[model samples]
Structures are given as structure tokens and as C-alpha cells.
Target: MRNTLNQRRSTRQHFRLLEQLLVATILLQLLNKPAVPVLSTLLQILLLAWL
Candidate 1:
């Protein structure tokens, strides 16, 4: 019974860690947009010229 409780606690901790990681990834993507969005848009325009 004690082992089962420990397992549950560990699983909850893992889920919390995953949630934090997902939030961090989303925040990083948002932070990158201002720096990269225009570059990507320009690249798309160049690609269109090629096709």
C-alpha cells in the first residue's frame, strides 16, 4: 500500500514536470516569433519566386 502511494506521487510529479516543459516550449516559440517571423516570411517569398 505504501509502495502504491509512492508510485502515485512519483507519477504526479512526472506529469507536473511535463506540464512545465510544455509551457516552456510554447513560451520559447512565442519569444522567437519577433526574431524569426519576418525571416521566414522573406524566405517564403524567395521560394515563391523560384517556383
Candidate 2:
């Protein structure tokens, strides 16, 4: 039981890390482009839904 709990915790940590990386990459890519308020807002909404 303890081992299973540890495995689950580790899995969650991995997922959290991946989520952070994905968000960071998206933000970085968007930052490279000229600012578009509407597009950024839509992207944020989509990203939130994905998470």
C-alpha cells in the first residue's frame, strides 16, 4: 500500500512538471509573436480547458 501511494505521488509530480513545461513553452512561443490580445486570450482559455 505504501509503495502504491508513493507511485501515485510520483506520477502526479510528473504530470505537474509536464503541465508547467507545456504552459511555459506556449507562453514563450506567444511572446515571440506581436501582441494580439484576442488571440492570447483565446489561447489562454484553450490552455485552461486543456489543463
Candidate 3:
């Protein structure tokens, strides 16, 4: 039981980090090219799928 709990915690942390990275990437892309709506929409879709 304890091992399972630890594994779950680790997985949660990994997903949290991934979420932050994705958000940062989205922000950077938007900042670098505000005119690229297609890429932005794709990233938003990817983020939504993850959630």
C-alpha cells in the first residue's frame, strides 16, 4: 500500500511538471509569434486532451 501511494505521488508530480512545461511552451510560442493561430490552437487542443 505504501509503495502504491508513493508511486501515485510521483506520477502526480510528473504530470504537474509536464503541465507547467506545456503552459510555458504555449506562452513562449504566443509571445514569439502572435500571428500563428494554427499552432496556438493545436497547443490548446493538446493541453485540453491532457486535462
Candidate 4:
């Protein structure tokens, strides 16, 4: 039972890390593109954070 709990904990941690990386990558891409307006970018960031 303890081993199972540890496994689940590790899996959750991994997923959270992946989610953060995905958000960062998307934000970076948006920043790199010159056409994205500031309001849209802020909205996108807020949306991602909400998720």
C-alpha cells in the first residue's frame, strides 16, 4: 500500500511538471511572435493559469 501511494505521488509530480513546461513553452512562443497583441497574450496567459 505504501509503495502504491509513492507511485501515485510521483506520477502526479511528473504530470504537474509537464503541465508547467507546456505552459512555459506556449508563453515563450507567443512572446516570440510579433503579431500577438498584449491583451491577447495576457488573456491567453490568464486562461492557461486558470487551467
Return the TM-score for candidate 2, rounded to 2 decimals. Answer: 0.61
| lDDT (Cα, tens digit) per residue for candidate 3, span 1-51 | 999999899779868866776676678776886655775676677567756
TM-scores of the candidates are 0.62, 0.61, 0.62, 0.62
Overall local distance difference test of candidate 1: 0.63
lDDT of 2: 0.69
Candidate with more favorable, higher lDDT: 3 or 4: 3
Residues 1-51, model 1: lDDT tens digits? 999999889778766765665565567567875645555565456446544
Range of the 10 consecutive residues with the lowest summed lDDT in candidate 1: 42-51
Clashing pairs in 2: none
lDDT ranking from best to worst?
3, 2, 4, 1
Answer with 2 or 3, whichever has the higher lDDT.
3
How far is 46's C-alpha from truth in model 1 (Å)? 37
Which portions of model 4 miss their true places by more than 4 Å?
A: 33-51
Q: What are the per-residue Cα lDDT tens digits for candidate 4 across 1-51?
A: 999999889778866876685666678677786544654566567557645
For this target, which candidate reaches the highest lDDT against the unseen true structure? 3
lDDT of 2 by residue, 1-51 (tens): 999999889778867866776676578667775545555576567557656
Give per-residue lDDT, candidate 1, residue 20.
Answer: 69
